[model samples]
Target: MNPSQPSAPVRILVIDDTPSIHDDFRKILISRGNDASLDAAEAALFADTRSAPVADSFVLDSALQGQEGLALLERAHQAGEPYSLAFVDMRMPPGWDGIETIRRLWQVDPALQVVICTAYTDYSWSETIRQLGSSDNLIILKKPFDNIEVLQLAHALTRKWQLARKLAARMWDLASEVERRTDELRTAEARFTSAFAASPIASTIQYNYNHCFLSVNPAFLELTGQSMGDVIGHMPGELELWPEGKAWLDGVSRGDRLRKHPAKLRTRDGRLRDVLVSTEPIAIDNDACSLWLIDDITDRLELEQQLVQSQKMESVGHLAAGIAHDFNNLLTAINIYTEEALHECQPGTRLHDDLQEVQAAGRRAAALTRQLLIFSRKQFSELAPLQLAEVLDRILPMLRRLIGEDIELVSEWDSGLPMILGDENNLEHVVLNLVVNARDAMPNGGEIRLALRQTVVLASQTARHPEARPGQFLVLAVADNGCGIPLEIQQQVFEPLFTTKGSGKGTGLGLSTVRTIVSQHKGWVELTSSPGAGALFEIFLPAAPVGTVLEATGTAGAGQPASDRHRGTERILIAEDDDVVRNMLAVLFPRYGYQAVLAQDGPDALAAWEKGGGAFDLLLTDMVMPKGMSGIDLARELQSRQPDLKVILSTGYSAELLQQGTTPPIPGASVLLKPYRPDSLLAAIRNTLDAAAAAS
Candidate 1:
């Protein structure tokens, strides 16, 4: 196919009687660079009898012995040699004349070029041509044929043969190229098919309208339980086992080309399976085909259902906690009132003793409510950077009391442990819950080992605990040499209301609440136990900065001491929509030597502040009310009017509004959690007024 290659030389064969004719033709052909050979009658016969030379040749006669030339032509024919031009001499005194010879030669090689030579203008020559058939290769010459004519015929015939050979070679190359390309295409298609079939997700191809399957990979066959023979030509919807096939076809007809749908399929064995199917439209040769990908999501869907159930239980727990919180506030007020009344009477008096019993009962009810709030995750956590050593130092005495005198408690603190961001009270609860579980695990007696260490959780380690993220963590491990949790019940230990303990022994919410609280703080809990070995509960919390280690100064067993009760007559504005709660505050504040003004909502509170001539020492407002205004908005307005006014915003559920910061700066204030005691309320008001006076 390279154009620079020279063309092959043309070959010519001339058969005639005269030696002079042969000489003339050879000279002409050789001059044209065409390789030519002359074979006399004797030589031709000898060459034909022996091995013939691999070259084109011309035979000649003396217009006599025509039988000899004819014999030579038969020899050439038998050899399968092509003759380009044959000039036969006419008027030969032989068995046959030149015209007859030409006719015979034409019969021998239809593609051979022939030219007749004669001395006379014979009409019989025309008759010979008619018998030989109308061929472009056949020509006639008058006697005394000019050399020019002979040379011209030789050149034309040779060029024609050359062109024919070139065309044939070109076609052969083209055929080879086409075959090679076809093989390559087949190989690529095979590779693609292998890759598609090996994919983990099930893949299939179906015709657009009829939904007839075009091709399905092995995964598809495995998923559908149908072979290529069963599915290829039939409409997918017609297959009764695949109900979703009909729905999928309907969706495609409505122009939804790509979709993700969940389906239930009946397999070949009549087993039903849940499948998630995704389909995409592929256009091949301008015809639409659909590609389907399927996944088995029954297990995943079931887990999600469990998660939803868990969330619902958590919601119920929150509702219970809110009720408990409200009830606790009422009990605090009742306990305080009863105690005050009891103190006024003599200890032996009947009324005094009755008041004492009421006070004691209220205190017990309040403790139960606090535990309920903790279980429901409604109790506020005072989170701070804490050291493990300090927590142990403070909580050991209480822990000893909790486990009783029979069981010994030991601690192992890693001195290199980093500070953890957590609530000290919640941490104590975590310790208490684990300790109590350990105690129950060993009904008789056992030692509780509490250990803390700095650890790193890598990405590889996170696989076992799917909820955990890889990072450096502070591991607080509680291991008890007690009877271990059973393998069957280990997973259920963190489920709310699930317990191994009998009904009266436990509420079954302790471990569940511990896990919830830890999760809220972006931490994870791991429980390891078996029948013989003691249980190990490892709590992993992300480590805080080392510089953040601040020792906790307060005792874990006691709340912060009440601030000095302020007895000064200070004007306090209270905004509350609840009339009963408002009336209680109004009567209670004045009894503590404070003037309390009332307002039903934000508007009324603002109006009362405006009328009070800026005389109020502090603004105490509820967060949610009937009007469009909120406590935050009212506080902003009050601050604008009286910049120095102290404000304490109160809310039952203010989580949605609280942003992440030490102090979310409202214009005039600090926020107080709702349902506060009289002492706490007085302390907050007193502190705010004192700070205001100091700033002035």
Candidate 2:
């Protein structure tokens, strides 16, 4: 045995009647000084040339009687350091014979190695085997046996015992590991079950072979509007969930792992829902299955579409506003020149009538440009606190005629509704646009319901719509029972130039303009519709504050006609960027009994003012100008020098638009919109100059 090997010394129990036998056994197995004697005896017995074996390393405990030996073996086994082998004298006469002692010892430790030593024929080998019942642990060793044989038996038996103990220890560790792993698996399964039940995203498990639902979470049940009783053991197709049942089943059967796949499913209530589906293969109780996670994105997609539509409209609005502003400048020149030609030509002449037609066309073109500006939210509105009912009542007759006899028009409103601060004409346009859209939606004729109601909005109601605010509002709803708007296209209906009608049938600006007009009034629009179920468009306008008294819609010249009162002889300075409009104004103003001086832009006007010693009575300048000076800047600089300077501001852009980029028009300054007639410009100039004179 190697000394470096980590093992306890092998122990042996000896049973004998002679004291010498016990001492002999110790000398052969435990005593290292007896190695020389053992070697000489081995050499003489065989006359071999081989060297003696390594000194025996063992512990020996002796008992005089068989019973004593058995007691020693039992004590050693109880102490957890049992003997590996025992030498029992077969002729020992004491409390019990060697055979009886060996039987009891084997019972105590079945793995113990035993050797029966006997010189006399107390029993034959066959009789000894019959007594011990023949075991691998039992060996018959004749008395006076060779010392080498005793040493060999002790070493082999002890090493075998050590290996057995190590094997048993390893088996025990393996058993413990298997138990721990099983416990962990159980814990993981429990956690998975709990999480699956608690998750908010709809989850489902279905058998891989049958494609029938094995389990469904509460969220799945709620999302599909189905109960456990309805969904259990049922295929998705059998439940009528998928819009394309065949396609769904085919994909599932193909083992396709869906990740964020867009799908449409019909609910139990027959409403369609947009969902994102994800699935992966799983196994439950040795059965192959698929785990599905579904997310309902109907509302989210609607909001995203609304956001994109809003951004698109805003961009188009900007472009439309710019185009309208530039176009209005051209219209101004056209209309003014046409008016001048009409004054020059004789009435009832062909030339005069042609000029009148040209003038009429110019007015219509101007109206179209104004509509563009309205859609862009750049049109100035003359907002007033008025009863919406009165405005609607005035326009319903015209609407009834517009929608035709096939369509029945019905109007209803709650009494004592609060007033709104909105432009009457613009509000009328909103109502007309919605009603027109409704009428068009029902080409075969249908009922149109126009309703007005006051509503109080809450902060919580604004979660879905970012444009909504918390306040009281007057809701104007136009509903039609006609071929309804589809859910997929509802978000696009409000975008400019997005029309469902054929060519030349619609401008596509109806709903867009309605939204723009409502937004300009500090309001929002809500639309609800289902396919083949009609559409409802609701316009929410902020209500005027309580106790707000309506003011009379009148001006200083209400008592007299505008043309008669608008003449003035005061010198007026005009600044314009367009040559045609500028020249037209220069010629037109002097004809109205006013002294007119012209400049190309604000800087040129400033130099002219300085050259003439600021003698002009009123400064009429365009809002947007050249040479780094706006109309507002020029007025501010001149007013700084002349505190009582009278000024009139003109622009093709709305006042709201000008305020966003530069300084707003000064207080007390009159704003004259472009494409103006000879009367409107003259009225503005005369009013501005006369107001200053009256103040002085």
Candidate 3:
């Protein structure tokens, strides 16, 4: 077995009186070891399964009698690697029968799957059921069964057991986390109760009637600028802490108990501070005393304001996603129809000009929809090892055009900077967003410098930021000598749709997209600025090991011409939900010399395939639909029936649907992101089909 294989085998126990039976199971269940040939054969046979090549390896343990089997199971349970299945013989002699053995095993581990093997009808089905009761985990196997049947049963039951254990573990983890969080909250409340602002909050103990300080915590001393000796045994009026005299101090009993009183306290340095004082009376050493809880509301108010802004941004993100989903469907229809019409018109015609304008408008709207998805953080980006220097080289021309010639753009990077794991295009978007934001800040024009260097971040350095960690990073900085960001609003600069630019000029999503992209790349952004000085935005991306090469990612750029797209007369099946979009694809596929068959959903597509006698050159299906079957399942079924068929899945939003989150790519199918141009979609189909042909 490969040591790096992620999952361990499902263990099985065989309890029988005959030693020969154990030898038979070993021959059927255990392999010498899996190798390249076995893997290729397994993939060929079971490629339709989501987790293919998962032929369960078994660890078989045998016992001569039922009593000894129970002992083994108990020991396995103690070892934390209990058996997933047990094969019990009905005719075990000189001990408890199969039924009793199963009963005892269930008492220890109720989740064990059991299969009863017997040659004679010694215990009828009704008798077995009456003794053991019916269970989903119990099944009966007649003696002399085929080797294939037993092996198949082993594989299926073991996978079922593994899935159940994982689910139970996940539920346990969630319960544990909830209890842990509740404990933390209770601890915080206890700290608030017992300490009375002694730790970080300002606290002062004063005597009654005269209101002279008896003791002051360090926090209080710092706030009031008074030493322990200076504040002790001296009245607040004498020290000028609260120079309004003791009239408010005497009002504790004059109004109500446990009331909050507002006051202005003057520090020794003559600076007045706003405070909320919670006054309560207590007896200390048989004398009346007051414990005043003074809270500085300056920073607290700012925290509350930030909480409100965060809540507002969350609501806006939800709204943006809902709108983008609906808008993209409309854009899909508009774009296809305009492209189809453009082909029928002559050059230099007014109709052609009008259609061209419509297409341009549609293109701009599509770009805005992409921006909205990026802001909402729903845009699918596949992260990989990439060099930032190469990304800069690819986008420098566009960057130069973005910032006018009035602004001087400078690029600097280290000579041997390590690679970072990120989505290359998304990283480019971050650079563009930040530099454009810097350009907007300097209306009169200024220099914008983009720099990349390697740095190490210590734990102490990340103590202040929640999204940062201690590690090596590729630091990308975008700095501008522009009108600096005010300290008051610097924290809100990355908020979605919260722009300082005037209407009709900026959409306020630039910095918002930048923050989302950087964070998604497992990095953090730190901003430093002073009023009218300048601003520098630093993005720190976790660095991968040296020699990590940049990987090629898929793109939706204009592809080869229709002739070069491997145009063919092969028939293709398309399953989509939207009527307009489906009909448009049906019309467009024939233009590339491919025949088309259409269905409204997965089931409809399957029915069409069956009606065509399960034969087609290729299958094109949408990832989502209103029917019971998804495109992934539909493809799996069709591929199982016709092993050589080429398949392509398209989706409007998610790229993870077909593979379902980081599971390896589907063995024989390719994915096309939705709202793809006509030429691009054809190219994807042709390339996939040609590859299938070559493999065959």
Q: Please list the C-alpha lDDT of all candidates, in the order they appear.
A: 0.70, 0.83, 0.80
The candidate maximizing TM-score is 2
User: How does model 2 fare in lDDT?
Assistant: 0.83
| Model 2 agreement with the true structure over 1-696: per-residue lDDT tens digits | 111222466678888889999888887776747457666755675465354324455778999898788889889877777888888888777477889988988888887888888898888878988988878888888978977788777766676777776776777777878889999999998898898889999999999788899999999999999999999899987888888647665776567788888888789999889999898988889988889999999999989987987798789989998898889999998988888788789999999999999999999789778889898878866678999988888998999999999999999997788989998877887888888889998989999999999988999988646699899989999999988888888878888998988899998888888887888888889989998899999888999999987788666667886557977788788889888889888778877788888999888988889988888888888888878988999999989877777888888766666657646668788888888887777777777777787888
Tell me the deviation in Å of residue 451 in model 2: 5.0
TM-score of each: 0.58, 0.79, 0.62
| Model 2: how far residue 131 lies from native, Å | 11
Error of 2 at 621 (Å): 3.4
- Which of the numbered candidates is closest to the native, going by highest lDDT? 2
Candidate 2, residue 521: CA error in Å?
A: 3.4
User: Considering summed lDDT, which 10 consecutive residues are worst modelled in model 1?
Assistant: 1-10
Mark the regions of model 3 whose C-alpha exceeds 4 Å error after superposition: 1-203, 217-250, 253-256, 259-277, 283-288, 293-314, 338-360, 552-560, 627-629, 633-646, 656-668
Q: How accurate is candidate 1 locally (lDDT)?
A: 0.70
Question: Candidate order by lDDT, highest to lowest?
Answer: 2, 3, 1
Query: Which lDDT tens digits does candidate 3 get at residues 519-608?
Result: 878888899998788899999899987678866656533475555555788899998888888888878878778889999998898899
With a 3 Å backbone cut-off (N, CA, C), the pairs that clash in candidate 2 are none
